[model samples]
Target: MYTGNLSNLILNSDSYKTSHWAQYPSGSEYLSSYIEARKGDYDVVFFGLQAFIKEYLSTPITHQDIDEAEMVIQAHGLTFNRAGWERLVDKHGGYLPLRIEAVPEGSIVPVSNVVCQVINTDPEFYWLPSYIETALLRAIWYPSTVASVSHYCKGIIRQALEKSADSSDSLTFRLHDFGARGASSQESVALGSLAHLVNFAGTDSMTALVAASRWYRMDKDMPAFSIPAAEHSTMTAWGRDGETAAFANMLTQFGGAGKSVSVVSDSYDLWNAIDNIWGGCLKDEVQNMGGTLVIRPDSGEPAKVVREALERLAVKFGTTINSKGYKVLPDYVRIIQGDGISPNTLGSIIDVVLKAGFSADNITFGMGGGLLQQVNRDTMSWAMKASAICIDGVWKDIYKDPVTSRSKRSKKGRLALINQTQGQPKTIKLDDLSTTDNLLRDVYVDGKLLIDDSLTTIRERAGW
Candidate 1:
């Protein structure tokens, strides 16, 4: 009945996992903590560990389940230790005896080292479950990567918006998540979408929308939003000859005052559709309908095509200078460049738009693979390692100082993330920090979600 990925279970044996289990010191679990931090590229890492609460910690595997797993792996001609896993689970009544303390959801945590910590909170259970490390950590890397990438995209757009838009409040909705279809799986879509929603409110991925709500305890008032739009199939289905009819139908459906609709214009000649069909035939109708028409160019050299398209649109609907001295497109017309968009390239495209005398507010971005799926733990160099271990009621600092890569060296002792705008490396010993001032709070402890963050609270912290 469970016919999904067995990779994490079967293939993980090859991660030299026996060594991982053996590395921990004997009598190591009076109270030990490991920090999960993005150790490279990013200085401040946004926390998006909500998915693990539902998928891993809440779904406990019994001793019988471990025995069944051993049989399942042996079916593939590989050896597994059912007895080892069952013995570990027996100490805690088939539940993981761990506590996860994290910077509140959406908190901008300094990654000069440690952000979230996974520790054995219960003294009755000695030795942290080795397999659970991989289980919980695998869930964070993807969502955290997406959230980090998406958060910086907001920074890029925010800077551009401050220079061009009259009001900078629309930065959150400027980049829409179009990544659900391109994600590796539906579960991948859910994780990536919820991560994106931490900073922005726009999405085209209904899979993401539904998944986030289901897993994160989100209500019907979902954190993400979307607009009516057509894909290549929907547009090309009408045929080139019936292009005008297709355009007319979209107008009839979505072209009302303040309404936003995206119509793909490159199914045929991109220019002819914009000039003849949309501008030539429907210009007055668009003006009279009093709605925003989002012209989507799915394929072409991004900077050149967007600049050329915007120039022609300015010629058709006309433009006015904003207070920031950039040309602002008419209220009813805009451009959306959905292809070839990454964090850097997207900002550059808007930079080109600003050079071409158009405000950044006139264009928004919809990202697919780039926004959600096409990154890894290395994208931000995420790692979770044992930093402190307690033996015989003594909390001793523990770390790995590899001579080859000093950056791989782990921090020692518990962590408390501090928000500092100075933009330098932030490091403080846990003993030096007061409990009230520490940003990392108890999130999960012994099969209970201690602190559940509301979507609004998360949004506000993310600079809503």
Candidate 2:
């Protein structure tokens, strides 16, 4: 929906980038910049670049956009490159003359390797790559960070299930997305939630569905699904006196054969809802239901509360031991911990359940702000730096080696990511390897998208 001036690519950069058009060396004819995450606890899930290229770079710049950018930049005390933009519009049909090569979307790349390389196809626009760094880096880092976090959580859950569960049948639904409302904007909701969906099939974020359909070519087969669930307002609206009635309503509406429903049960006293009401009053109603009832506790120390809730629920509903010797509740009951979940806490909660002799299948997770808003560009120390530049048809290697922080040092020369049969992928200079040896694919060139990845394709590459 962002149209007119807001959608103008010329205005998407930082105001200082306007001045950068003149800051480059006088004979600078081409500049090469590459993006990489210099440090992190684990490998990254490289994503979102395809979506950005399709959404932003595919649109041709118009004369009106140049005019609007000129007025805004001048009024804001920055010089605008009107003639440069005009020439781009006139000669290149309004498309940027840039070639973007990147690792395949959803590739689980290790830290400190080049994931994307950007260089101008037309030497006249040497500054284009660095000028668009603001938008380009933002596009790569945010969703890629979210995806990495979600991917890490998936590994935690999978390990727990392997250690304690009889089967990993519910692995894909182990972590649910509850981060939509906690996101900073709808775009964040869409991109962040979609990144989570790459590793899981459960979500309550609908914006991610629309985005997947639009950007990742998921229209025919949607990548995520959600069940009918209740929040605090719905439970409390019936009054404390009518608490049992609200529980009954959810069971009546969504509880049936081959169906499930989630109800937030911590509005008042979480223990009372589990012990007095669900255990005493509606115990029979729950057991006789044809489908599973997921009880969500939204306020507590996550690990302690989940362990206690699992113990209390087993006492009332009874539990059967799986082949792995871990206790699992009957098909009619389950627990979901939606409070205080983040990458840091996720592994501990799963570990706690496993240590308590409970099957990982007996529980799922719902993460909100922790999943979407908790990360930033610095989560993995992501940076886009000029590694090489061309002047008058001669190329020279360039990079920064900050003595203050060795981790901030960057790579030099034109980089290429190549696969190694034995270990991690290697980042080498392009001159050392033939073009065919590089794993970096030309995904975008002169306004044309060469690789259109689908959600299914991304899921496969991410090891889903």
Best by TM-score: 2
* Lowest-sum lDDT 10-residue window in model 1: 7-16
Off by over 4 Å in 2: 1-4, 434-436
Q: Can you give the TM-score per candidate against the true fold?
A: 0.90, 0.97
* Model 2 C-alpha lDDT versus the unseen true structure: 0.91
Q: Which stretches of model 1 miss by more than 4 angstroms?
A: 1-23, 39-45, 72-91, 122-125, 419-425, 434-436
Clashing pairs in 2: none
Over 1-464, each residue of candidate 2 has an lDDT whose tens digit, in order, gives 32356799999999999988889888999999999998897688998998898889999999989988998899899898998899999989999899999999889999999999999999889989998999999999999999999999999899888889888878899999999999999999989999998899999999999899889977357788888999999999999989999999999988888889999999999899999888889988888888889999998799999999999998888999989999999998999898999988988888888899999999999999999999888889999999999988899999999899888888999999988877579899999896547889999999999999898889999998
lDDT of 1 by residue, 1-464 (tens): 75544533323334444334445567666544555554644444454566677655665557656755665666766556555566557766666677888777776655555667777766544445344556566676778778878888888899999988898888888999988788988878878887888888899878766766666666447777778898888877888898888887888998897798889999988898888877889888778877888999989899899999998888888899999999988888888889989887887898899888889988999888998877877777777777677776778887789999998877887666654557433556678776436667788887887876666677777667
Clashes of each: 0, 0
